[model samples]
Target chain A: MSRVGIRELAAELGMSISTVSRAMNARSDVSAATRERVTAAAERLGYRPNQSGRTLRRGATGTVALVIQTNTARTEMGETFYFNLCDGLQQTLATRSLDLVVLPVGASADRDRFLVNAVDRHLADAYIVSNTDRTDRRIEYLTQRAVPFVTLGRGGAADHAWLDLDFEGVAAHSVARLAGLGHERIALASDDRDINSTWEYACGYRRALAEHELPADGGWEIRVPDTPEGGTVLADRLLDMSPRPTAVVLAQETLAIGLYRRLREAGVEPGRDLAVVGFRKNPVCDYLVPSLTSFEVSLVDYGRRLGEIVIGLLTASPDDEPVHEVWEMTVVPGESDAHPPCEKAAG
Target chain B: MSRVGIRELAAELGMSISTVSRAMNARSDVSAATRERVTAAAERLGYRPNQSGRTLRRGATGTVALVIQTNTARTEMGETFYFNLCDGLQQTLATRSLDLVVLPVGASADRDRFLVNAVDRHLADAYIVSNTDRTDRRIEYLTQRAVPFVTLGRGGAADHAWLDLDFEGVAAHSVARLAGLGHERIALASDDRDINSTWEYACGYRRALAEHELPADGGWEIRVPDTPEGGTVLADRLLDMSPRPTAVVLAQETLAIGLYRRLREAGVEPGRDLAVVGFRKNPVCDYLVPSLTSFEVSLVDYGRRLGEIVIGLLTASPDDEPVHEVWEMTVVPGESDAHPPCEKAAG
Candidate 1:
């Protein structure tokens, strides 16, 4: 006879596996009635606890959710990222028996409908919110609903639990690196994929400029989409400005690649005429003719941490304090950002 | 006060939520002994049917697993493929509250583990094996165990539920395309990442060669790891062969990209330099300096079909025959290949 599994049982029971496992594990907090029924079935079916089963039953689902924009907008963490993150999450969660569920929101999707429909059903215990913005409707809904969720970057407000890179801090570091190169007149190649992401980055750039005593000129910030083509177009636009900036910090890796193409087209070598830095490195980094200097984020670790926090939030008592976590980021140097000729700063 | 969700109640019950929901929904199959216990307690707590509770326990978990190998070798799906599959699966399962579970098998993990650890322990009804190959460990395991499963792209000799691309027929088509291009000495580029995947493509190439009354020469098959660098390394070696191949059919996209780079470096252009064709129209196909011509398998449809099969298996009688599905493959033309000037004798 085919072994009866959760699907059949759940269908017969009219409940979720998370609920069934939770009750069967005798999580203590499960209601007296649920405990009674679950205990009876375990007795009847002789369902004993196994490793994955035990963990699955744990209030922590060993599962985390990465909420990002539509498929097209995503440049980093391509198919490989999803595969690898789940691979890594399963590696860690399997020892305890966890899984990863990826949820994508349509560009034209209703944020509230997506979150409530996608997440509120509570398949995953906790969630990892990626590519977040300041006025993220989903985050706000989650907050009001009091769902335990984590953000990949800083949210509009700082109250939620998140694992984020310090946009301002990274910007400051970039400015410092560029300042040391003796390039005063600099252009900013930015990607406005989302208002929120752009805003976080712009805020950081502004702070860095204020600290370095550089002019916060209008032309200095050239906003565009985050892609190679976008970068190329933006590069040409920046170059057309008379007395063009000598250095640039390309906010997106694809944009950075575009910058390289544009520079080459204009007979401007990256190292000699246009010292540059990029954010979020992708493959073909070293393979690029000049290679690219960019910042790196550990997506695998990010996924694992999200699993931990989400599971914690799901299992924790409603009254329990919100769990918040901070993640670290680092900068990687490459040929693109090498010092050109030194020049006076534009104050 | 925050209402106690079904998961919380079920966790307390020492039983799976399916049982609880079944007991609540009052499915006649459940023993009175179980029902009385669940109802009495549910009534005691004023527990009403939560939408998630209703949907989750009512039918299939609306969750399906996309199982792929996690070890040294990887035959995975592309971003478009993965998301398209999800989109298709979601369209069918969403109204019923289904979710997709991305299952990456680690070195120690096997197909059975998914059943015991994932299906039995956690809350999944069925699994879709992505990157299935001849004599696949997971497919064999799933078939033998009578577990609900479906395959995409590749399949095993075993007769079970599966959705596959017509690789053998496609190879014949590829032969016809090359023949039309007036190419006599054709070569094949096979990835060494996974022997099963490479073998499948190799077999197809052989079939096509045989159909066209072509010889499978020693220099015809070149094996390399599935990477651009591997392609680059193989290109020089291929070019050095005494009887160089006039045309090449690459089994991987990354390898094709590598070949492109090598050809460019050697002062050769793709279509003009050497007629080349490849499987898997990858993400950057359009963006390539010259767009690549390759096959586009209906991954989303494949996933959706698998989801349906699993749902059927879960809901149908145990004695039902395994549903078999063979998906179609499409060939897209790019600047890669041309036909032979004269007609060749058919096999």
Candidate 2:
């Protein structure tokens, strides 16, 4: 049997086309009896709402696009983290009958331009902007256009909803854990890019050092790309230090694998000669020779929170308070950072 | 200035709305002079075609969705593989001004229902379906609906474009290499699911064994989940074998990490006591103490080729041949599969 359209439904119910549309859309102006009648008739007739028509009338696409940046560097390790988050978001959004579309923006000169074009074209009803830098122009652009959005990372001077990981808290906890192990000299390997999380991580590291009454040397803070190669570079630099660090905390867990390799190559054994702590727990971490000591955050929960906040914002009144959440990261101890070094080292 | 829509543009050019739209959309029915005049006026007035209007007229959306299945199991190692492929697809599509949307289906009961709804709603102009099983109902469904799609894996009884990894070739190569190193008995640790690739892998393994005049024992073939835990389980099974296989081929590289840990715990050094070859070369593979020997496929290139095929199908005439591609994986030799065991010992 052929599918029935709204015109046929309206004709069958002896109601105006606009009235039938309003009733089917659950508009408050439609009478309750008329709404039920229209709904029942539409259901019986096998009438499916044309998405294009509904979108034209309501200006809502019933879809949220999570725009993630993808490049050679990010694709290697960032996939699991983001995919888990996407899965979480999908689960939460699915309940609301909202589809989640992941928009991957490549690392190219026109990346910003492409985002702007997508926003202008109304590709999605709302956006979840990720990989936000310290001064993200997308935030300003989206805000100025009055487009509904929620960022995965905080950006500058935009009154928008956001959900960020407590990077500072993670760094503080890592420092405290290592310090309690009788390690005085500790190094931090963090993202070199001007992303807001990197800044937060650095701030947390220094604050923790100050709280523990230890020296916060700039030389000990290594800014590196979030890659395995970056981890090797950090390890090499640590080895060349005047007295070498007794322990090092890595912001990116993916780096742990490379750091272990570089440390072994330099005749330093992780968890014995040198202790290491990674910021996030990954699948590879459990398989490491001395399983990596890393921080853990339920990515599914993170995505669920994002979904709730974005949905709340979308459905909230214009004057409603903007949603903001910061997820606290907990450390998962492993053999990689079991104890302090036997020999005290000065750097 | 306010946006200049089709109505205003048609009025300014003193032409029928349909004629203006036809001319702007480059229909052959419009005269060259009229088309040039319409285009010039549109450029002068900064007039842009509305996407919804265009979609309604053309019956196509300028977007493609890659529907990837997401769950705890797939997220562990599949993320990087899929993300790199996505990045490649995006790069290729960006050149043609076609947007790529990644629709992640959760591993819940509603997964198939969600896909069907998306298909019915025409959420995307075309879909790139991944993680196909031996008898994927989605393939048959899409084929019946005449939906333009490209499957990343093979499916049953469907005349459609597909791009699959050469799993059989990789399995054959792994068996031959290990056999050359004096390994009489070998094992294959592959995905336990009924995916077409798993079937192909089993076929290739048996074919290689028969060619080498060796026994093709079913006990030597292990079907496990594509996870680190699965690898550990396979390692345990190996330890209990009557005459343990000297070499094992892992279909999933992520499994190598757990296998190494389990092997080390059991005092069986991977490179010395047993040889291991992984199917894919991942970032973690390089960091393993005895680095894993695995097959490598440029995911970016794979994605680019998918884009080419899908785009070709989208633009092809009805009678055009369906595009199909199979990527050959190259073995990246590492320390893990350096040599076979010197003595064949009973467990």
Candidate 3:
């Protein structure tokens, strides 16, 4: 049987092609009864819309783009995470026959201009923004342009759809675990960036310290670049503290391995000398000498949820509320975290 | 100053628009002198062809796509490498006002369909293929379609452009170094995949062994999945050998950490009990207890070279020779590879 077009369907239903098109598009101008009638006839006649023609008419490209900016200053610690997430997103999008286009932006300053050009060219129907800062201007720009987007991290206004990692929960859990292990003087290593995740992690650390009745030492919280070199530098500073921290929490898991190496070189065993807790669990964590104590979040689920949220936003009516989700991670305990030597000896 | 259009440039040069377009496109129908004259006039007049209009006329998208299929069975070891390479390619393309699109194909079976759809829709002007097999069907498919492309690894015919790592050189160098250290029973850990790199690495290993007058042990050439789990399995197999190999060479660096862990658990110390050498030097290599002795390739340079090859292929005349380049990697020795205990005692 030949596939029926909108024109054929309209003729069969004794309606104009414009009316049928409007009904198919869910336009408000079409009456509910007429839309139901037109839809039923179209379905019965096996009417399939021409993809290219529909795209031209609706200005929808049937593609979603993820723009990533390469930070030349530091080695990216989240490569595996991003790759896994992209795979998950692609899998989810494939179900809807939507293509995922990843655009790598080389220069940080050219990101906005590149995105604007992509949008103006009708390259994609929606976008997935990542590496968000606390006060990201891209959020405002995209909002003003009325482009449908979902962010991997929190940054934009509450009205925008976003799926952020539960950094606060991770911090709170790490602090509480260390406190349980009789660690009073604990240090936190965080990324030296304006990203919202860093702020959230800091907030959780401070709040958990208060809850545990631990004094907040200003010098204990160190900001460093997320790299092995940064971890080595941090190791020196950590050892130089007046009352050295018995336990250290990393905001990023990538630094854990480096910290271990630096500490070992200085004759400090990771788990026995200073308990170490990482933010995320990676394959490398399993191979660390003492094994890194870290949290694990299902990246596949996170990405799939993001895909669903973005699809929801794109297909929703204007009056519908934007979706906001925060995913919590589970901590995977390893030998890297243990009671301080004094506590262990006393026990 | 305002940008000059092709029409205005044609009028100024007193040539028909079609003639000017053909000359600018470097069509065979246009004389060499006419083509040069047209290009010179276009440059002098500051004539910038409208991007969208030119794309429609030439059936080009002004974009290059790298389609990567996710390997579900193994933990992706080359994530950082690919990410870094993509960044470099994007940087190179940005100079020419060309966009790089990354299309992630989830399932292996879906790869061909995805590429077909992408090409049929005119999503990109060219492609960058990676993780090539010895008998890759994608090469045939793309060549038949007459689409411009470049591969990161060598395969298909000599008529295609490819920039491949010097796997054979690496293997030869590793074997020679081990032989010089008086180790006659050196094992080789290679990928089980039917890829060209694996074959090349095996070839290099055998040739080097023959040159060194070392007896070949069929059981020493172990093939395993390129993952940490695979490393653990290989470790067990290596230990089970009647006369365990003194040293081992890994095709992938990510497996080194896991092998170290397994060896340690069995009361074997890496660099002491068994010397190990890895293929690539990554950030993880530095964090391992004894560190890893591996080859280091400038990923940025590799990516830039791949970008140049693809750009060259895209712009070259049909009769021009296809570029084939092989990049040699430098060995960064760490504690991972050392003389066997017997050899050390003998010395």
Candidate 4:
């Protein structure tokens, strides 16, 4: 069935196209009586305004593009993160009658090329860039084009609106918690990716160690793949250490599950033999023999904050400063790090 | 900076709007030399055709929407399922220059209302509706309107294209596997949702029981929420059974995690005390104390098949048959169902 266009609706109502358009748009210039008649007639005739036509006239797509990384080695965590975040984003965007369009860029695809096409095609009024890296060319391109965009994570781009999780704060707190528990040689398992959060996490780990007057053991700050398999690799590395670190902080909490499994297989028990702190408390952490000590991030609320900031950036004038903020993560204590270092490990 | 418009490009090249438009569109009427010159100048001036304008002219949105449910109680599994499926969908759609837009419907929202709005707004050239119910109003509405759409799961819609997983086959296979091991009393834990798969699973379980000459015990069939917490609730219910079931099959594998935890806490080891079979093997199943016996679904390949079917539907003539297919699931052997009923329970 073909949609009834504005021309047909106007012809049926015996009214001018401009009047029908204005009435449909709910413009104040159209008299209330005429607006009601036009609305009734349009409804009766099933005449919904075409999005493309309306978008061309208004210079607004009534859409926001959320660019995310997909087809990566690890997908569950990232997909879950965005899925929850999208709920909040959708709820918030609904208030303004804007649709959220997710543009999933394959891991192997050229990220900047995808962004360029989206921009050139005017796919959305604004864009939300996720899985950010330290030197992001996408952010740079958006910045140069003066397009409205907000990054889910901050990068090296200059003076743009961004909302990032408090990875640094979580790292510092986890280090302090372990240090106060008499853990001197605390290890840090950071993601090998050049993600901004990884860098922040490493920085916080180093700063906390310095504050504790502990030697910066290069071997303790090993970067590995941010996956369950990588967690097994990390466990192997820890076992290879002559005097293993008493405690470890994992930047990617996903690694905790594999770490626990591998450690147990090696006759080492988490919370009893070694202390572990991870980011993101989830099902795996909850079901682990000894619950994992991890940080809890309310992704829905974070998504809402992102939506608010995106709206702010879109509506704000040029003189208004671009917002930059961090979302705090709360620590959910578990049995994974219940004890201090074992006596034999003091050496 | 403002985007360079077609009018400005035409003015700069001293050509008519028609000539420039035809050249940019690569019309055969335009000489190759002129087409090349127009393309070079357009590129140099950064004059890309507006998507809205092009869509209005061509009457094709060049977008395919994948609608999925979100914000439900059992989110991890659903999110993971769609996330993996989307990768294949996107990869296949990319071949035809069609962008996949994910429209996540909130669990609490009116689903029909969402679909109506999406349809009214002409959101995409086609849609892939997922989480199908037995009598889906959205499918009915889409079918009535003659909208181009394909469901991810089969529904009650008439003569429509659909691709569904073989839930019936999986259920039958699981029942036979346990029944073959000399288990007379078997239980089936099905999802409480009104989804079509749940109905098929229940049917298969009942049919299998009849074929094996075992009583179709009403008490053995229970419908529960499809979440880990639901799994805990299911465990409690099973423990309360007067003559507990010897083996069980779970329609949703997510419930297996919590069931394992609760059962272990109750001093009833899964594989030793009672046999368990689950659907969709994953990390939890792999890491379970006794690996879960579950079906392996290659979601990416399933997604690719869906993409192929959708494209077929879109390009096929009216006289052509509407495609309907069921994807087969493979069983992954595990230790969860390593034995039959214990000797003491034989009575």
For this target, which candidate reaches the highest lDDT against the unseen true structure? 4
Better of 1 and 2 by lDDT: 2
Cα lDDT tens digits for candidate 1, A186-218: 677676656455666677777777778876777
- List TM-score (chain A only) for every prediction: 0.73, 0.80, 0.79, 0.81
lDDT of 2 by residue, A1-347 (tens): 33365567888999855567557657576789999999999889887543222222113567888998777465775366777887768777776678888888765536678779888767788889988888998888888888888999877554788878888888899889989998888899888888888888888889999999877778999887788788888888888997788888887777777788898887788888888888878765655768888887777767766776666656655555675656766678888889776474333
**Between 2 and 4, whose DockQ is larger?**
2
Q: Compute the DockQ of candidate 1.
A: 0.14
Each model's lDDT comes to 0.62, 0.77, 0.74, 0.77
lDDT of 3 by residue, B1-347 (tens): 33355557778989865567557656566799999899999889876432322222123577888877665333254255666777667766665667788877764336667778888877788888877888888888888999888877887464677778888889889988888887888889988889888888888899999999988998999998887788888889888886778888887777786788798888788888788888878764556768788887766656655665566656655555666667777899888776554544212
Rank all candidate structures by their TM-score, best first, as comma-separated numbers. Answer: 4, 2, 3, 1
- All-Cα superposition RMSD per candidate: 17.3, 15.6, 13.2, 16.8
Please give each candidate's TM-score: 0.73, 0.81, 0.79, 0.82
lDDT tens digits by residue: candidate 3, A97-150:
777888777643377787888877667888888888888878888899998888
Q: Which ranking of candidates, highest lDDT first?
A: 4, 2, 3, 1
lDDT of 4 by residue, A223-331 (tens): 8887778889999898789788888999987788788889888888888788999977765456676888888776666676677666665665556567677666779
DockQ of the candidate models in sequence: 0.14, 0.39, 0.27, 0.23
Candidate ranking (DockQ, best to worst): 2, 3, 4, 1
Candidate 4 residues B261-336, lDDT tens each?
Answer: 8988887888877899997776545677688999877676677667766665566555546656666677998999
Question: Which of the numbered candidates is closest to the native, going by highest DockQ?
Answer: 2
Which model scores highest in TM-score? 4
In angstroms, give how far residue A168 of model 1 lies from its true place. 2.9
